[model samples]
Target: MLPIFLKTLPFFAIIALGWFAARIRFFPPVATEWLTKFVFYFALSAMLFRFSAALDLTSLWDPAFVMAYLGGSLTVWLIGMAVARARGLSLPEMAMEAHCCVIGNTGFLGVPMLVVLLGPQAVGPVLMVLIVDLLVFSTLITLIISGSGRGPIGWRTVAPLLKGLVGNPMIISMAAGLVWAWLRLPLPDPLVEFLDLLGAAATPGALFAIGASLVARSASRIGPAIWLSFAKLTLHPLAVGIAAFGIFGVQPFAAGVMVAAAALPVAGNVYILAQHFNVAMQRVSTTILISTAASIVTIPFVIHWITGGLP
Candidate 1:
């Protein structure tokens, strides 16, 4: 247990450093934004593309694993929506709130954390979770939020969704890599080296940006954000654990990885999406901060449980 915790320490420690830097205004305010953009567009996509390219195409397909993950997340999202409705949140706000409940920082946090905790093999499963969270759950939220706006939800709403999906570098890279893998195309030495450099930066850079984002003003209403954080850090993983180990009967190691991925902090993308839709921005942003900071404690226990730690 101590060994697992020690191994996981550096990732969160880097995040804390980023938070401290931001709080101190160590770098220009806008620098973190540029770092985030570089991560989303360049480093993260490059890592995904390179991993997918090298992986066996057969290893990338795991329908049962994917479904189990989505099932747990959808359940949590629905619960969030219900809670939002009880609180009299508007439709778009409810949608965004529900999204914040489920779509975690799987790409930036889960991928690197799991890679450190588990190994390189964790990449495929983590990437699969990323794809589903972005494509399926995010698309669903967009449609709901669009419908909640003044205008009717029509082909116009879907056009932007399609456009955004097409323009997303991560999706594009994943597609290209899958195609390369299918064809068994070999990457040139120089290209592989370049990608390796980019991939190496993805983890630390992302953690830094996440910490900086936390320095901004968060939602004032701490109560709801706390509950949402609880749901994200606790309930979400419990649901995933049941689905993976009981329902799906996955192998022990794979199931453990699935639960750990599910246990990751709420995604930074939630705040981006909330800001874009202009709904529940403060609340969702605060949720990200709380869930992330809390994960430093919660995640260690989760890893120990998954690994069968003894007293």
Candidate 2:
């Protein structure tokens, strides 16, 4: 247990450093935006592209794996919605807070942590989580948030979503990589090296950006924030475990991958979505901050269990 905790400490340390740097204004204020842009536009995309491009087509098409993750995510989201509505939240507030329960920081945090803990094999399931989030959870949350009180849903409501999905760098990179993998295309050595270099920087850069984002944000409404964090850190992974181990009977490693990915903190995208729709910014930011800080303790234990530490 001590060893596992020590191993996971550095990931949190990188984030802590970022938070401290932001608090001190170590880099220019604009540097945060630039780092985010680089991770979103370049490093993350490159990392996904390289992994997806090389992924086995069979691995990409796992129905059992998909069912385990997507089903678990939907189940948790519905539960969150029920709790939010019971709390007397407005429709938009319910949507925004519920969104945090389902979607997670998969790209930046999940991918890097899983890759470090489980290595390259982790990417396939993580990619599946990303697809489900972008295609299903993200789209559904958008409709709920944007469509609320505005009128019946229509093309106008969905058009922006489609456009954003189409233009999303991570989605585009993954799709291209899938196509390339399907075609069994070979990349030139120079391009491969270039992508490798960018991919190498993605994990640390992303962790740092997350830490920095937390520095300015305060965890408001602590009770609700902690509940939402529990929904994410505990319930989400529990659902995935049931689906993967009991229902899907996925292999241990793959099951572990799905569980760990599900255990990730609320996504930074939740903040972006809240800001875009102008709702629940404080709650969303607080959730991100608290859940991320808590995961440092929770994840190592979760990983240890999945790796046979738990009886």
Candidate 3:
């Protein structure tokens, strides 16, 4: 466990460094935003595309794995909604809290970190998890919020969701890479080198950006934040683990990766959605801050349990 914790430390340390820099004003908010944009559009996309390009489409598509992850995540999402409703939150606020429960930081944090710790085999399952969260659950929340007080769901309400998904750089990069893989296209030597160079920035830059972004988040809503963090860092993984291993019988290694991905903190994107919709923004922001900090310890423990300390 200590070894696993040590291995994961540098990643979180980079995040902490970013947080510290922003906290001290050495890295301002505008700089953080630009850095996040760079990672989202360029460095991270290059890494995801390169990774997806190398994967066999068959390996990336697993109905069992998808079912297991979605089942587990949806279970947690429903639980979050129930709790929020018990607390008397509005429909949008309940949706936002439920969103925080299931959406892990797979793109920025899980993709880079899991591939490094768990190996290249981790990429396929991690991508599957990302797809489920981005496509299924994200769309679910958008639909719930859009249809809430806007009266009747129509193309007008649904069009923005389609546009957001279509224009998403992560989805675009992954799909394009999969297409390139389907055709068995060979990447040129020069192109490979360019991608490698740019992609290398993804890990550190993403970690730093996450840390810097947290500086702007105030931990004002401690009680709800703690509950959401618990749901994310603990209940999410437990539910996913059961669905993967016990119910669906996903492959052991893929199931392990799925559980680890589920264990990630509330994604930074969750806060983006909350802020955009102006629903439970403080709770979502504080949840991200708390969960990310807590994951520094929880994540390593999870990896150690799943991997049996082999690495």
C-alpha RMSD for every candidate: 1.9, 1.5, 1.1
Q: Which of candidates 2 and 3 reaches a greater lDDT? A: 3
What order do candidates take by TM-score, descending?
3, 2, 1
Candidate 1's TM-score: 0.95
lDDT, candidate 2, 1-311, per-residue tens: 78778878899999999889998999555888899899999999999999999999976678888888888888888888999999999988887777888777899988888888777888898898899889998899889877888999999999999999999999999999999999999988998999999998898999999888887678688888898999999999999899989998877778888898888889988899899988988888889989998998898988777666423
In model 1, residue pairs whose N, Cα or C atoms come closer than 3 Å (at least 3 residues apart or on different chains), thus clashing, are 105-267
Candidate 2 lDDT for residue 243 = 90
Worst 10 residues of 1 by lDDT: 302-311
RMSD of candidate 3 to true structure, Å:
1.1
Off by over 4 Å in 1: 149-152, 309-311
> How should the candidates be ordered by lDDT, best one leading?
3, 2, 1
Residue pair clashes in candidate 3: none
lDDT of 2 at 275: 90
- Candidate 2 C-alpha error for residue 171, in Å: 0.3
Which number leads on TM-score?
3
Which stretches of model 3 miss by more than 4 angstroms? Answer: 309-311
For model 1, how does the per-residue alpha-carbon lDDT over 51-161 read when each residue is reduced to its tens digit?
A: 889888786787778878888888888999999999998899888878877877888888777877777877787778888887999899989988775587889889999
